[model samples]
Target: VYNISKEDGANICQWEYWGGNGQKFILEPVKEIEGDVNADGALSVIDVILLQKWLLAVPDAELTDWKAADLCEDNIINVFDLHLLKRMLLEQ
Candidate 1:
């Protein structure tokens, strides 16, 4: 299990890997934002805006991994993230 954060520079937030036991790995939920695309601690239009900018070539910090934005697990954050965000907004 993993927790995603939206605060700037927040890394990993929390991650629990399988321990080889029957117990499921659990991580503390991120109360600030759920499904923050850019992990900036809030699920707002800003997250979608940032993702658009990043897709358009805004360079991320050297240590930032692109996987953080790959919301659909498609190995890229493009139209997939956009669609996902749209769906989320509709649900909200």
Candidate 2:
């Protein structure tokens, strides 16, 4: 659990539990790695395989970050993206 200071530069005398948006702090944006469909913080054959399974409509197939798999920068997720993912893996 994390509690934020009530005001900037104020001496925090006491801490309290998070009070939803009223006390929540802005979180740093997470940088998503391209081709990392599983959001494992790294790109590898596992990501490629996950994207492939998602495209093939395999049961229980899920993409943690579909946008990361969009290597082509196109709105569609198809064989082209899969090819690009594989190429990226080969390059790495």
Candidate 3:
């Protein structure tokens, strides 16, 4: 299979799997889902919970993609985003 080299400026070539991070990669573009704060490829209650925890400053709580939580497109995550996310979830 084709493998990507870890060394900078190295060329990609056929290589056996060594179970490294560079061994595999996505060739297609990934579409980010709005409100998918946890970035598990879907919007759900779990994402809401994560966002909530992150906003409340819960230790160790992290958002996979903070931009996804910016429902207002204002480059900020806040109560407004949470409100909109809840509304979107309810609509779905």
Q: Return whichever of 2 and 3 wins on lDDT.
A: 3
lDDT of 2 by residue, 1-92 (tens): 23334655545433565455445556679887888999999999999888888989999999989899888897889999999999989999
Give the clash total for candidate 1.
5
Could you tell me every candidate's TM-score relative to the true structure? 0.48, 0.72, 0.73
Clashes of 2: 0
lDDT of each: 0.58, 0.83, 0.87
Report each candidate's C-alpha RMSD, comma-separated, in the order given. Answer: 10.3, 7.0, 7.5
Error of 3 at 5 (Å): 17
lDDT of 3 at 6: 57
The candidate that wins on lDDT is: 3
Question: What clash pairs does model 1 have?
Answer: 6-39, 6-40, 6-41, 7-40, 7-41
Give the lowest summed-lDDT range of ten residues in model 2.
1-10
| Position 40, candidate 1: lDDT | 61
Residue-pair clashes per prediction, in order, are 5, 0, 0
What is the full ranking by lDDT, best candidate first?
A: 3, 2, 1
* For model 3, the run of ten residues with the poorest summed lDDT: 1-10
Candidate 1 structure, TM-score to reference = 0.48
Q: How accurate is candidate 3 locally (lDDT)?
A: 0.87
